[model samples]
Target: MTKEILYQKFGYVLDDSLINEIINVGVFKSFSKDDIIIDINQPMLYIPLLLKGHIKILREDNEGNELLIYFLEAGETCTMSLTCCMGKSKSKIRAVAEQDSDLIMIPVQKMKEWFHGNESWRNFIIESYQIRFDEMLDAIDSIAFLKMDERLYKYLVNKSMLNESATLLIKHQEIAEDLHTSRVVISRLLKQLENEKKITLGRNKIEVISN
Candidate 1:
């Protein structure tokens, strides 16, 4: 899937030479949904380039409370991992598989070489950083300004888009954990959304109907 995946996403911007290097040096790995890929304070090693499925970026507090930072779709890499690798520092964020996923894990040593030797790679890095930074800001805004119900609905919409399905196979408890809230609160809001005809609640799935 190397040629197919890369061309589908990065063909317009990434050069053939860079693509070749990726094909050669990148190690392919697969992960199951909810599997933790990056952990807090874990040493930076290889940076994962998503080939298929989705990943969720998260932040954990000193008290061990977790908050959603952002979601990564196919063709994206984690900027936090990039920063940690270059700085030779431990990772401060956590990355979890949002779905069963395939990825190409590129060695950290090649990060600098590719950045300098390939203009396309450099642009990709810069652009990725900007994109992640903006998403981080949006996460902050949701927590600060948006009401819990609004945040929950937006989360559902984003999750639905990432999963490429209107029906989400998830639990209210999982939603509460991701949003850093209580299960009771999430259940209440979910019922409210159902009543409003924004979504339909099933046994273990929520089908997004409108927004």
Candidate 2:
């Protein structure tokens, strides 16, 4: 694949030389929706810079239930993966393609190569850590303070935003899995949301009410 997408997606934040370094060393990869890009205990070999679509970051429990950490959109990289890469440790979370997507996978070594020489590269990494840190804090707050119904609503709204559509092509069981709950609870909550004029449900789909 041509590296033009990298220039287009990252041209604003990354300096030309830094972007070219990425182009020279980065491997372009694509993932279909729902593909497992990274799994718990997997070694982090490449740092992924999303070029298209969204990726969902998730944490799995000892029993395999999952809680969504956040979503990575185009122009974003997963900071958790960076941590794992830098430490030479296995991944602690899972990443799944939220939609058909493209990414540039830069080898782990280049992180140190460009960090000091390229101001833009350094800032990008630092800022990504800051951004993801805030998101993690928000995730913690949600778990600590929000009711299940409110959390479900927020999750639906987030999906709608990520897909850039009012309608989400999804299943209740999928939502339950991400929320680390049973499907029956998700179905009941979704119906309650619909009755409250928050959303409308259909077979394997959800339409979030905007007004």
Candidate 3:
């Protein structure tokens, strides 16, 4: 895709010359579904622009529980690269492709050059950070203020809106991790929701039946 298209999709624009320079320095890569795009504990060096497909950002706890931080669809860049370029010793999260994907890897040096030379690029970076920060805060608020059922309800509602099919393709374990609750608790709450005619559970999907 052209830089203009990418900018329009992301709701931010970059100078044409700078965008061209970045494209020249970046490499296009394809990954299969479930492929690890960024590994944890590694030194991140490239900013990956997801051109196609969906990805999940996750981190594992000491007990080996994987916690989902966020999900990124096409047009989002990996945040790990920004953290690394800012002098982080190791990446704290892992990025995995949820489906067959295409990505553009921009070298850290190229990003620094753009940041130094293009005010628009710098503003875009700051805006991206602010957005991510707000998301983190919202996640924290959900964990602290919401009950498991409420969290699950909101998650289902969001997924329903996104897919237009009431069913959510996420696994129960993943939902538990996202809500910082146990699998048993999530299962019980899901059953309760179903009993209340709020949702329906299939093999691996939960369909929201009520708002």
Error of 2 at 133 (Å): 0.9
**TM-score, every prediction:** 0.96, 0.97, 0.86
Candidate 2: segments with Cα more than 4 A from true spot: none
Candidate 1 TM-score, C-alpha based: 0.96
Ranking by TM-score: 2, 1, 3
Model 1 score (lDDT): 0.91
Query: What are the per-residue Cα lDDT tens digits for candidate 3 across 1-211?
Result: 6565555555455666766776678788899988998888877778887777778788788887777676776766765558776674678888888778888888887788788888877877877777778777777787789887887887778656645677787788867876667889998999999998999889898888865
User: Looking at candidate 2, what is the lDDT of residue 183?
Assistant: 98
Collision count of model 1 = 0
The TM-score, computed over Cα atoms with residue i paired to residue i, of candidate 2 is: 0.97
The whole-model lDDT of each prediction reads 0.91, 0.91, 0.76
Give every collision pair in model 2. none
The candidate scoring highest on TM-score is 2
Task: Give the per-residue lDDT of model 1 (tens digit) for 117-199.
Answer: 89999999999999999999999899999999999999999898877789999999889989999999999999999999999
